[model samples]
Target: MENEKETPEERRERLRQEEWKGNPTGNLKDSTHRSSYGSLVDFVGGMGWKGTGMLIILIIVGFIIYFLFFS
Candidate 1:
């Protein structure tokens, strides 16, 4: 059997596919896999669309209350 060498791009694609398949080996760290959002965004995303809207509404209400009472 002939062993074929994979290019860096191919290797990254293969690893990304494996990660999507739920086989996280934890050997390689790919920048693309990292989220750009901070913990707050991650929390809001985890809550789904409806919860995200609700969170936004609550934040707006809180800001309004803060400005009216203190600022």
Candidate 2:
């Protein structure tokens, strides 16, 4: 019996082929995977895009006021 030795590039190509067979996209997919971060984004997004934009702008203004005056 003989073992075939492959080069690094060949091994990488083989792994890529296997990965593409599973998920063509570069993103990994796991059935059990639920992101707390994405949930938070969704929660904030429920406030509506316009409201979210206003809230973000208010936060920036508040920070500028605090830093320039209070600090």
Candidate 3:
């Protein structure tokens, strides 16, 4: 029998499914497979001053775009 090689995405999905099956409650606090944004939020929150600086920069950029195009 020829073994079918799984793609990276397929492997990731399979692993995610296995994780879900192992934890039917879907409680993210105990799960290792956090969503990308959840990981980002956790990282930013941990950064303290650096996180605040990034957020301020993002808000400034948003205001610039809004005034240039929308207003």
Best by lDDT: 3
The C-alpha local distance difference test score for the whole of candidate 2 amounts to: 0.63
N/CA/C clash count, model 2: 0
What TM-score fits each model? 0.44, 0.40, 0.34
**Candidate 1 worst ten-residue window by lDDT:** 27-36
Q: Candidate order by lDDT, highest to lowest?
A: 3, 1, 2
lDDT of 2 by residue, 1-71 (tens): 12158755456557767886878454344222335235544456467678888999999999999999988
Give the candidate order by descending TM-score: 1, 2, 3
Give the Cα RMSD of candidate 1.
11.3
lDDT of 2 at 61: 97
lDDT of 3 by residue, 1-71 (tens): 22268755456556767987888778465354675335654465556667779888999999999999997
Which residue pairs collide in model 2, if any?
A: none
> In model 1, which regions exceed 4 Å deviation?
1-38
For every model shown, the clashing-pair count is 0, 0, 0
lDDT score at residue 69, model 1, on the 0-100 scale: 100
Minimum summed lDDT over a 10-residue window in model 2 is located at 28-37
